[model samples]
Target: MRTTNRPASGTVQSVDRAVTILELLAVHGTAGVTQLARELGVHKSTASRLVAALERRRLVEQVEDRGHYRLGVGVLKLAGATTARLDLAQEARPVCRRLAADTGETVNLAVLSGGAVLYVDQVSGTSTLSSYNWVGQHIPIHASSNGKVLVSELDGTELTRMLGELVAYTPSTVTDRALLEDELAQVRQRGFAVATDELDVGLTAVAAPVRDAHGDVVASVSVSGPSFRFDEARIAEILPLVRTATTEISSRLAHVPPER
Candidate 1:
């Protein structure tokens, strides 16, 4: 058994080696198991296991079953997803800014990632009060308006699986599974979602789904501010603006609504 250099803190050695194998194949176009073992400074069996795992996931494919492998279609699929996410953020920037200006509240773009709402982009409003920057932060899916809108399109089983446990972030958070399900149904019916002091005390947010070309909810657009400022009348006033902004973003993503 040969010993390879240990990975950095919090990094899994096997996973790191597997990724290195993919990078190696990407650079070399194709490589044999023996060659990969030599380059990775590992035993042949270890390299074979890594290659087999990637091959099982379709991340690598055997070259005509001649003991050589190359990157596979799964890599392209992952690249396409990454490109789509980048495009979604870029396309929503202007609309997010316009919404922030119109609503006088911070606007954010979020997508569901690893069972959490991942904030990808944001635009701050003109308010003097400092607002927290949520970009690159992951919030619980059950405790945010943006999260609700992102998950509103999912089916019952998927929704259940995505929300593992309804952890309460604040007193206003909906911790009940049944109640949350009902709220999600409303979000789907009304085409938007609202969270008042759910994720944090005195914070309120409203969000609408941003669809892709296939009409699937790929992300959410939201406006958030102090709960006191998001009163009933104010919510009524801003709801239309949020919905319109999200619609425009969806259109920019080539989403065509079905004709009535």
Candidate 2:
């Protein structure tokens, strides 16, 4: 019979300890269980269990059958993900700047993460009444234009699973799952999305999908401004520019157009 030696605290503690072990290995090249236990100020048994879990995940590996552990391929995999995100932000910066200049409204690049919209980059437009900086902020998926465009990529079942209950942020916010589905359907057909006084009473935004090399919707490009300034006529004028910016960014990401 095999007994599992789980961490005493919980998942969060286990993760923290695991990351610390990785950091120790990074600084020292390789470390034995006793050395890692001393560095972590935990029991040797605890360190051994944590290292075992990491090894199973391919995040750590031993030099031999019973030797010191070192970082593994999983670390490189995580590093690659971070590098890709940085590249995405770098590639989208110039495009967002151009969109902000062309539309005279704040431009943002956002991606869907954990059922919410995560703003990764932004460029403020030439306006005295500038909207607040939203980079590194997470907003609800049901209330923002960028969120709508991002969610439009998910199928019905996956969409429903992701958005359990549509929480309303403002009076105009769509809280009904069925209605939100309908709106996403329209977003798919129109190739863009609009949110006016939805997330905030006086905010308005328009967004288009940004695709990756495989044509997957990886992110969205949004132009946002005060509601009064983004009335129907103004939105009509700026929509094309926003779409063009998204297309340019997607092209930079190596998205090839489907052959007609």
Candidate 3:
């Protein structure tokens, strides 16, 4: 095999090659297995394997009627999360605070970062469940209410990629892939995701999707407290509040067309 600029150390070989394939697609629009192998200086089969992996992850997709591949909507989902962070910084802070005040529970603004939920902003309520600042924490995508809301938008292939191996965070956690799929379906149907003692024994959270102008789910807004304090009746009351906060944040984002 020949050589490329993929880092020689501190990276898995297959991962490096996969990323290089994406970079190649990004720069040149699209390429087939033969061209990609020639550019990567590797055997065609190796390049094909890398492409197949990316395709499985929805990071790359086959072009219509051609064997060439290009970047996929999954890439947009990752990139859109960054844009969501930027939009949320200014528009979502007050909404989070209001939700915290209304519900007296911790409120978090999270986006899908790879297969994890990256909490970007938080507001603490009167209920002190944990002092740990959730901001910048990467929570497993299969565990939290916020994660469920975020993944509800993913297609079947992307959903599989996000849920590689569901680690049981708690006994109540959904470990079966089919069950998790059902849960996400309910989230999409009802416009909310509820995790009751699923991520932590004493924790319960309810989340709603934050949409952009195009109505795509970009982030999730959640309100969480100890399960004891978040009974079925209590969750019922907070669900509307969570929905309202998400609606407010999404409306603000969609109110006006972005400048050029």
Candidate 4:
């Protein structure tokens, strides 16, 4: 017998309002009911109802002033929960280590989370100048090689929604949305990406996409270091090696799929 999946039907207005309240708090740092109602274009009573529901879930908390709300500790808890089980961090560690050892440059494994590229794994290089490990760090999508390669997979609307306003991380980061679109187009055509001091001064990275059996990009593998050693020529030299390592890791992941 065949079964049909029924579409959900419920009062999603409250949910939407709650999300709006969260977004407003994230953007404004804190807000009172009146401000939230105005931002959401909803009635004061409706905003109050939404805030009440969110308060019950610990997603939002009333500030000490009694009239304002801000994001609660529950959001941190939820974020931590995701950080604890980032699968790429676990699966890519050894691969990254091998790549770093072979290339004598820092190797990174990153996944797109929210609007940023989350560095879940890093293997330090042999260079003494290569700074601290970057595990659990986030880099902007338009300012990192891995981020650009990952962003290349997204549709235009989804990409715009993900990047949102394109705050410049550094002077070199592409802040113009149209220019970034053109850059992403180039990344797709090139099959890899290079970022020179876009995220930080004197830092450079070369990244290639890791694809699954279905040939869809799942993560990125990158080699990153200071500009003194990771120049344009050096990045071009290592691009093939990074791409090779990415293919190996993707094959391993496809053969031994991680258990959910």
- Between prediction 1 and prediction 2, the one with superior lDDT is 1
User: What Cα-based lDDT does every candidate model obtain?
Assistant: 0.92, 0.89, 0.88, 0.81
What TM-score, over all chains together, does every model reach? 0.93, 0.90, 0.68, 0.65
CA lDDT of 32 in candidate 2? 93
Instruction: Please write out the lDDT profile of model 3 over residues 39-149, one tens digit for every residue.
Output: 888899999988998899899999994789999999999999667578776799999999998888999999888779999998999776565689999999889999999
Tell me the TM-score of model 2.
Answer: 0.90
Please give, for residues 76-150, the per-residue lDDT of candidate 1 as tens digits: 999998898899999999999999998888999999999999999999999726878899999999999999999
Clashing pairs in 1: none
Candidate 4 positional error at 170, Å: 2.3
Best candidate according to TM-score: 1
* lDDT digits (tens) for residues 1-260 of candidate 2: 11135367788777878888898889899889988988888799998999999999999999874669999999999899878878999999998998888887899999887888999998998873646889889999989999999989798888887776888789999998888889999999999999999999999999999999999999999988889999899999999999899999999999987988
Instruction: Rank candidates by TM-score, best first.
Output: 1, 2, 3, 4
Candidate 1 stretches with Cα past 4 Å from truth are 1-5, 8-11
Q: Best by lDDT, which number?
A: 1
What's the distance in Å from true for residue 113, model 3? 0.3
10 residues in a row with least lDDT, candidate 4: 1-10
Q: What is the lDDT of residue 177 in candidate 1?
A: 87
> Which regions of candidate 4 fall more than 4 Å away from where they truly are?
1-86, 255-260
